[model samples]
Target: MIEILNPAELARAREAGALVAGILQTLRSRSAVGTNLLDIDRWTKDMITEAGAQSCYVDYAPSFGRGPFGHHVCTSVNDAVLHGRPHDYALADGDLLSLDLAVSLGGIVADSAVSFVVGGSEPPESLALISATERALSAGIAAAGPGARTGDVSAAIGAVLGGAGYPVNTQFGGHGVGSTMHQDPHVSNTGRPGRGYPLRPGLLLALEPWVMADTADLVTDADGWTLRSATGCRTAHSEHTIAITDDGAEILTAPERARV
Candidate 1:
């Protein structure tokens, strides 16, 4: 369903967005060498519960997934990209990890993700992969505004990924988000400009650009939820929740300058 947020609902979205952003950032900072993905999920659940927010993922049982997600946050490490269900693996130095999270607060939902290296190891390939997704996320957010076509955002995001020599998987991308976690107006990572649904004020979307290090083919892990690269190459992802506004796109999940 496509939910158009009224002014009050938009305000609630912003508030929820801020909570999601703060929690993700905090979790990212705390995650390091020796940290287990399941521990991260525990922390995420604790924070969300303490804040009186609801997790959008824990009970999500979509057809694409095997069953209920049963995780508070998605922890994608190394070859794993999207749908990364938290597990028992501990992060190692130089491990490229991505954390994606979403929550419902005050009757609104916000989603975001971030990719970074653990233990300050500057793995060149990992850095490049993460940078590409971040750039692509920026391009997608920049293209979001009232009256803009979803294709415009996809084209902008795809340009960065394609230019960086990464193959994008269309199986999953961005989607409209509001009171519920996922909504209508699917936004592919690549598309022709001036096509698809036209943007309108009050529409909120989570634009995520994720890529595997090599091939676009994905394999489900033994857990039945984690999506990994076919070749086990390292991967990265970047995402943000943005709102279409009368003037332009307002990025609801931008990292705070002070936090950065």
Candidate 2:
């Protein structure tokens, strides 16, 4: 469903977006060497409950995934990329971790993800992969506006990742989000410009650009939710929920800037 949120709905969306951003940021800070993946999920649940918000994932039963995700947050480490179900493993130094979250507050939903390195080891390849996705996400956001098309955003994102020498995967990409998570107007990571659904004011889109280091192929883990790189190469993903306005696209899921 393509939803054009009204002003009041938009306001609610902002609140939801902020909650999603804050949770992801808090989880990112708490994740480090020796930190258990299940702990991250628990932290997410606690924060969401404290904020009076609902998790879009925990009870989520989508056709693409096994029924009832049963996890508060997605924790993708190293070779894992999308739909990373939290497990019992502890993070290690230099491990590339990606956290993806979606939640609803006031009946509005927002989604976002971030990829970063853990502990002290700074692997060059992992850093580059993370950088590429971040840049691609920025490019996609820049292409979104009232008159733009979804393809324009996809093309802009593709340029960055492709230029960086990473293969693009269309199997899973961004999508529309509103009262519920994962709505219509599927936004692929790569597409031709001037195609697909045209942007309209009050439209909300979650733009995510993810890539594996060596291949575009993905393999599902035994858990039936976590998606990993076929080659076991490191991967990265970046995402944000954006709202279309008369002027341009507003990043609803951006982290709050600390006040000095």
Candidate 3:
């Protein structure tokens, strides 16, 4: 469902967005070499509990995924990209790790994701992949505002990733977020400008730009949740929850210190 949050609801959304952003930053700081995926999940749960917030993923059961995600956060490493279910695995040096998180606070939901190298060794390809997604995310956000079309945001994001020589995957992309995690107005990674849903004030959208190194195909892992590159090539994903305002788009999921 499409929701246009009111003033009070927007305030609650800000709180929820802050919580999600803070938790993601904290998790990124704690994820180091030798850290276990399960440990990250536990840390997420602890923080969510301490903040008196609810996880949008733990009890999530979608048609594409196995019922009940049963995890506090998504820990995607190396080839793994979306819907990465935390498992028993220790991060290694140079491993590309992507953490996707969503949470609800005061009845509003926010979602975000970050991709980074796990250790001292930063592979060139991995760094490039992460940079591309990050740049694309920024482009998408820049294209979003009242009166803008979702296609404009998609086109902007696609230009960045495609210019960087990465294949775009459309199976999953960004979406609207509000009282619930996923909502209407699906935002793809690539599309024609001046097409699709027109943006409006009070609208909240999670703009994510993800790509595989050499292919656009994806394969589900044995776990039935984790989505990996069909070629096993490294992948990266970047996302943020943005609120369309009268003036422009405000990044709700940015770190508190980064917000103006």
Q: lDDT rank, highest first? A: 3, 2, 1
- lDDT of all predictions, in order shown? 0.91, 0.93, 0.94
Off by over 4 Å in 2: 257-260
Candidate 2 Cα deviation (angstroms), residue 94: 0.7
**Runs with alpha carbons beyond 4 Å of true place in candidate 1:** 257-260
Judged by lDDT against the true structure, how good is candidate 1?
A: 0.91
- For model 3, the local distance difference test gives 0.94
**Which pairs clash inside model 2?**
none
Q: Tens digits of per-residue lDDT for model 3 on 6-96?
A: 9999998998888888888888889999999999999999999998999999999999998799999999999999999999999999999
| Candidate 2 minimal-lDDT segment of 10 residues | 251-260
lDDT for residue 218 in candidate 1, whole number 0-100: 96
True-vs-predicted CA distance for residue 249, candidate 2, Å: 0.3
Q: What TM-score would every model get versus the actual structure?
A: 0.97, 0.98, 0.98
Error of 1 at 125 (Å): 0.4
TM-score of 2: 0.98
